[model samples]
Target: MKIVLIITDYGSFNNFLSDLAIRLKEDGHEVSVITSETRVINIQDKFDYLAAGIKFFYVDFPRGFNPFAHYRSSKKIQKILDSIVPNIVHIHFTTGIFTTLFAGRVKYRTLGTFHGLGFPVLSGLKKQVFGAVEKFCFGRLDKIYVLNEVDYKAVKALGYKNVEKYETLGLGCDLSVFNPDNFSETWKASLREELDIGVNDFVFAYTGRFVNFKGYDKVIRSFLKLYSKNSKVKLLLIGGNDPIHPTGLTENETILMNNCEGIIHIGFTKDVASYLSITDVFVFPSVKEGMPVCVIEALAMGVPVITADSRGCNEIVQNDYNGYVVDVTDDNWSGVYEKMEQLIINKDYINQFKSNIQQDRNDYDRNRYVICEKSRYEQYSSIEK
Candidate 1:
């Protein structure tokens, strides 16, 4: 079977598609990825795709939800569909949702995986209006897969009968590469020394784009409060300050970055696992997410996580177990601050969280869950194309 995946950006395709392509190929299926040539992509990302035996196709999908321009992008997708004539079409993210809606019905078996719920970004009236559009899109797909439970409930609320949930492999980390066992305690100690971190210092790491909705500003405020109280705590930021992300950082983020001390910003790099190994605690205060891979990777590394109380985050972060899940809202940054402070003062709690994480690392392994995605594809392959 030939399966085609449609996604919004090259970065996501680079992060996720390799393992997926390998999984499909192992099943004797042909896999190809279709994405927009919008974001800046690395030349090595292309080689990664080539190495996985996956063919990559690029198209220009208009940024954001524009009904007018989407029509033309849909026509382009239709042309690609005509040429490839895939047995299964897997659409990802919002842009892919729009492309599927605009392209209309097709002969192939179509599946959609919702990565995030964008309704919260809209106003009351606009949200209700878009809700109808969302329903239309959900209704059209032959099968639906959602990452987080909130989206699962939202789709169920739409009363759709053909919805099944499947969590994609941690989009960024392959467990074979990210496993904590690969790095020794001495290696982590050496890395800390290399980064100028003292043995007593508490390293809090955040790995994602510098987007406003990710709530980096909130983390900054809390980190400042903690820093004032104790100088041993260090914050490491791993992603780029990309201004083009829909929820890109605001002026407040710039002010925070400029004013804050003991905060190390290491732009973006492919070596997130190495950083995760050295990090003592992973802090992610994203306001909206659909199963962030960064948090999962942190847990797999046996580093305790402190995340925002959002839909997808609930699945990975077990409060007082592996990490703490503080309430996520506009006025709850202080609540986030309080939680971080509690972790800093209590070494016993951090040790407890680490112990709990060690026992359950295998549960969140990337290799284990990619099988779920492959099985779904095989189920779709059984149906006549």
Candidate 2:
């Protein structure tokens, strides 16, 4: 079977979907990718895909909705669809989701996975407008996969009965790469030294794109409050800022990140495992998410997480068990700070949570989830045929 996976950016394709593509290929299927130049600052060279023996195509789709951009992208998608005539079409990210919806008369078996609620962070009129758009788009897809039950219930409640299908997919992590046993005391010490981190200093790490919806400001403010009181705490920020992207950090956020003390701002890199190895706690306050891979990766590394109590995040952070999920009210930063302070002051509690996470690591293994995805694709292909 030939499968075409569509997404908004090459980075997501590279970071999240590449492994699945490889797995599909090994299962005797031809796997290709279609991506838009949307919400991504760093686009990988064609040689990168060529080296991996996967065919790649790009559609000039903008970050957000524009009538002209959508029309242009639909034409491009039609051209690709005509050429590939894939057995299955899997779409990811928001732009790709909307593009597929508006694409005229899709003949292939189409599947979409919601990374988070379509209009989760939006409010009032904006939410209503985008929510209607998403409902219309979702109705067109043959199947939809959501990361957690929260998303499943929300999507199901959208009232698309007898047409659209929904499934709650448990996302996974690469245990081989993210396992707790991957690091040693010597290696941890070396990495800490390389990053100018003290041996006894407690490190709180955040890895993801620096977007406003990611609540970077909230985390920064909380970290600042914690840092002012305790000199032993440090912040390790991973991921880069894409200025072209609508949700990318604002000018003020960039300035704050630069001026912050005891905050190690390391730009995005593929070497997340190395950073995770040296980190003590994982902190992610993303406003919206669809089963974040970073959170799963952190759990696999036996690191307890402090995250926002929103869909996707709440599913992973089993409050006071593996991690703490704070409510994102008006005073979101204070809520986060309290959780961070509690963990920082209580080493025994943190260690216990780490142990609990280690025991449950097998549940988030990448191989298992890939098998589930592969099976779903096979079923869809059979039905389509």
Candidate 1 positional error at 76, Å: 0.6
How good is model 2 by TM-score? 0.92
lDDT scores for all predictions?
Answer: 0.77, 0.77
Per-candidate clashes come to 0, 1
- What TM-score would each prediction reach against the true structure? 0.91, 0.92
| Per-residue accuracy of model 1 over 217-332 as CA lDDT, tens digit each | 67777887798889899999887655566433356756766677688877667778888888888989887788888898888888998888787887778988998988867656
lDDT of 2 by residue, 266-307 (tens): 777767888888888899877778788888888888889998
**Where in model 2 is the C-alpha error above 4 Å?**
37-48, 119-122, 162-170, 244-256
True-vs-predicted CA distance for residue 140, candidate 2, Å: 1.6
